[model samples]
Target: MELQDHIMHGVFHSNGFGHLLCLNGLEAVAGSNLSGRQIMNFWDHLCNALRARKVSLNDISTKRGMELRLMHGIAYKAPWFGSWGYKFSRGSYGVIQPMYEKAIDTLRAMPLCILVHYLGSSNHDIPIIFSRYQMLSDHSLTTLGDMFQFMLELKTRMAEENLLDSYTGPGMFVEQSCRWSPKRIEMATRAIVEALKRADFRWVSRQEVRDAARIYIGDTGLLDFVLKSLGNHMVGNYLVRRCLNPVTKVLEYCLEDVSNIVPTQDPKVKTTIHQYRMSKSQLMKDMLYLYKHILKDYPSSLNVGILSVVPTAVRIILDAKYFAKEYHEDQHQARVEIGSEDKLSVYCTIMLRNNNINIEGTTTTLPPLLPPFECVRLRRSATFNELMVEVEKIFRDLYWGMKNLILDSVANLEANGKDLVFGQVEVGGKVIFQGSNKGGIGEEMMYYEGGSNWNKVVVCGCGAREDDGERMVSCDICEVWQHTKCVGIPHHQPTPQIFLCKRCENEIVTLPAFP
Candidate 1:
């Protein structure tokens, strides 16, 4: 073959999957076609022939000498040429050859590219050496060491050039994988506590808490991270009471007095206590209690979706009934009764009063009210299992009509009685009814349709969702469900006959076993 044709063939052979097999020779030995073995043997024989003619292996492996013999041509300029060289020279040396010196040169030129791609404009260096150098295909410790050395030199050069601030120190290559920092948690807790206090212990919006925390933690992203990490534990620790605001439809936080909070191991008791704080009325409190009882007896009755809308549904019904009575003297009385079989029945009559008045020389005439003049009488009877379902349906049906009627009644009450507030109905400065329509019954109905899983009572120290199919172990002492892995039980091991969580085990003293 002509020299040009031989060079072309060499380029094709060196750049093909055959070259990949050589690069991954250790791994490919068991998998690749043995045809490569014949080619390598031929190269070995040719090298030995040159050695017999008194040509040294060093002279054969030199860059110009290898270029002449291997006929790599321009393919040697490629990024992986060093690896190819290592493969080609491996038959002669039987060790990692000088080709790695060139590979180190290529790696030295890669620090700026790696740093720019990984770190970008952020001064917060990602504290992982492997992550910083993940762009490189070769991840051996030797290659990593060279990469790290180059990156350090680059940092020093940038600093000396005044490209970086004098105060900026060396990038700590330690792994910082923790979700929350101590300083962040402390700052976030202080900010939230202050926000709750500013709201006079009333429910404060999440935005308010974030705004308060932003002063301490400047980065918006970091602030959110801290809040999310701490929010769940805050509720469990009784540091804050979190609830979805009925008016704003946003999550709100209220400070809890740790002294007044009762710690309980029962998940049911913990859930009830949380709900009790959220309940606005005695009826709501009772309904929640009864629902919990029913859920205990019939596990299938537990529907977190339905229960989430209960507060808004009850508020709507009460406000509609109250407005009906206030606007019309002859309004039908609203009645709520608990049956002997633990069923609840609600009867509410919503009336739209005629407001268009005409005066004719001492004779007054009022026009008939709008198209929905006829009163909407809503009545629902449901057992504990059906309570939330029935309430949700009634809310969807009566929301729009009752909302307008309630607003009109409030306006009239304010005009005549001069006692109504915009957001609340108060008597003797005590809020009787929260009358805000910011997130009214319509919004609540929409939220129900949107499939919100708010107020779901999750189990385990890890707070794994109830639907997640993790293997769980019920503590013999507390009876709370916990993931087997969380409680230190291996997946292959059979559950112990008696298992107690650390909390429960700490609470009860165990007698020492007799020898």
Candidate 2:
């Protein structure tokens, strides 16, 4: 019930998550007692035509001709449709039936499994059915029991609180904002986070942080929203210090070769895969290089740009303290032109300021990039399902690409007469391919490791991901490992140095207490 509550009432756009899960639960309830057709006002018969929209059995739709074709949306990621505000949109809903039918064929969504589907392409970790353990991006369980136990405890709390109604679950009935404005987003965020804290929910906060993001783009340039929304705001000053190394390490590893990405049949396929991997590899490296050489000193420097699909063009600026300001364009301007893809865009310049995102002291103005450089591109879409399709396309291309790059990088360096090549990894440590000077790449994906909870996502939160998690140092104080990238420190830091995380730095005393 608690899981249902969480699924149903997400801040930005999560109805699809709840709607689908409720359909599953309703199916079981309907199955148990053939005569029990109604639970509260949610009638079992209502599911007659709607049931096709609700249940998981591949054949459930056989009772009716209607089928669901859903996918994950990038903003407020839920299994959404083609256009903005799709759930309430008839235009958007029309497109989903065909699209969702193609994507939601995973095992948990199969048959009648009651797995907690998180909905959409979870940036950090995805929900796994019949398994509690979260398989890392490379597909390994990073933690055990937390995601599953969180559910058990949530159900217990709902029962104890006497708040568990057939119709009303946790946030199952809360109304989310029409758009994620900074104020509206922050309010929804505070409510969910506070509620989860009271329930003693161990994880899922980071996932919430991402889902309720306030930054946005309309037909106007520079979405007038909060910086916390534009960036990984969950990373406090302490985490920016601790996690920067891991971010660098991961980027470095991404440069190296990986192994065990699923293989294919032909040689030409292999070569194409190599180009994709190298292109991505080169992109990541170039991003890092630009941040260090140019953006590091000049925040207002117009030298930066990014390549992505968005209706409006905007720029963003961030300082250590999360200082933010916005510029705007005409409000009534039309969103889509004669031809363009439906998507959101966020941009910020690389500026370093202590309490100052604007440099006032001594500084040198670097020349603007001749071609207008871009660091990294952030993609946005109306639904995670569309994002998933694009992401799947990338992964399909990158799957063999990631694997081939790993192998080729190793082979190339070995042939070049390097002292060291590929490093063997220990069970729960960093996966590195070593060299005389920080060489070789390791596979980002690992296989799944089952945990105590057999029916939940392995882990929760954006921070719990294995790709970024291994290099991060946990704060003895707050305990959350921290989000990716840097704010308080340099992108690359010298290792073996004793450091205090920002929570400790600010003298944080204890963790939040349950109500």
Candidate 3:
């Protein structure tokens, strides 16, 4: 509990999880003036001095506090990582440097026990606030503040990745009463009613808004929805954009009962109620589609631990713990408990491809692999082929399912006397829009995996002027327009569906029906 011990406590706590041991090892490796055993003994003393108080992840509810403690510990040993490798060495968090300097200056006299306790416990809120700032702040940093930039960037990246929730852990935002206060609940309800009015809707139809409020604020369903949406999105960016509306609604509803207003029974209110009902129905349908897509494509079976980076090729591994929820946890204790300690071991490994193949063939063929001359050996040739096949199968299933959903949505709009003129499909792979070119199916057009490419078809609007003698483009065997080279039809012989510079509008288009 001496002054030296107090400073050491702040220093150790700030250094993070295994800093004491890491430092000892580093000092020993460096052959510093202090011997390896002495370095280790000092670290041990520091750890023992701190272990007098036990803390767990649950003890820290805020990310900002957690980070402050981590930095406080790191400050005690400011010279440990040298200049470049320290993680929190820059940016808006340059605030860290002043704090570290203060800790160092004070450590010269502060008691070890008090300093350690303050950092290990009081500073726990650092991470919570720090993370929030990183997500929402845009403040520029001075030279001294440049060190904490990584903290800002890290927080931002994690939020975009939907990993923010995981980084902060559970119950950080959960209310102690297990429910919103009556005032909050009432306010939330009223907000829903007001939102409906702003949208030119009705308080009577506020039931849907109420339901949405319940899902978002009371039922914990909104978290799942937001997380699920993040599955196919860029996490941090997705979280920022996608969760904004839902979060706003939830906060409004829970903090301000805004959905229970009883407005005048105006004729416009009645009409707005009807429109609201229809829109609510459509929203439900869209949500169902999203839910199904998540269930089918990102099954619990596929939810394995994530590996952020790897320089060398390696096989992928999956642990059931990553994907599967605790069955007992989900069902609300409905299932019977078995023996006290019979934990099942469930783990699996999957092969991911690390190969590239070139597709080559005579002008008329669609060869699976690149031509022999162009083929290059891969690290895992067999595994790559298998992975390719699996990816293809997944793509096919996704394509068909999403295509149907798109068409069905369009059909539903048409049935409801609405326009489907400018809608898009929610597919994740190659787009299979009907097209005409010499190639069967014509051009294979699609946006690349990362939306990096914009491969789409463009055509002149109706009633455009053109050369009458120009070779007319038509599907070789169908009533569809196609470029001559797209259909694989020999230019010399114009097939029945093929046109030669001129054709009648009444010509019967024929070909196999689309799949």
Provide C-alpha RMSD values for all models, in order: 37.5, 34.4, 32.5
Candidate 1: C-alpha lDDT:
0.34
Estimate, for each residue in 5-108, the C-alpha lDDT of model 2 and write its tens digit: 22122121111111322323333343343311133124323333231122211111100111121112211122212121223111111122223232222211
Candidate 2 C-alpha RMSD relative to the actual structure: 34.4
Say which candidate scores most in lDDT: 1
Q: Give the CA lDDT, 0 to 100, for residue 187 in model 1.
A: 51
Query: What does candidate 3 score on TM?
Result: 0.15
Q: What TM-score, to 2 decimals, does candidate 2 have? A: 0.14
lDDT of each: 0.34, 0.23, 0.26
Every model's TM-score: 0.18, 0.14, 0.15
Instruction: Rank the candidate models, highest TM-score first.
Output: 1, 3, 2
Candidate 3 regions with alpha-carbon error over 4 angstroms: 1-42, 46-133, 136-515
Tens digit per residue, CA lDDT, model 3, 207-283: 44545545335644443332222211111111111122343353211111111211113444322211011132332
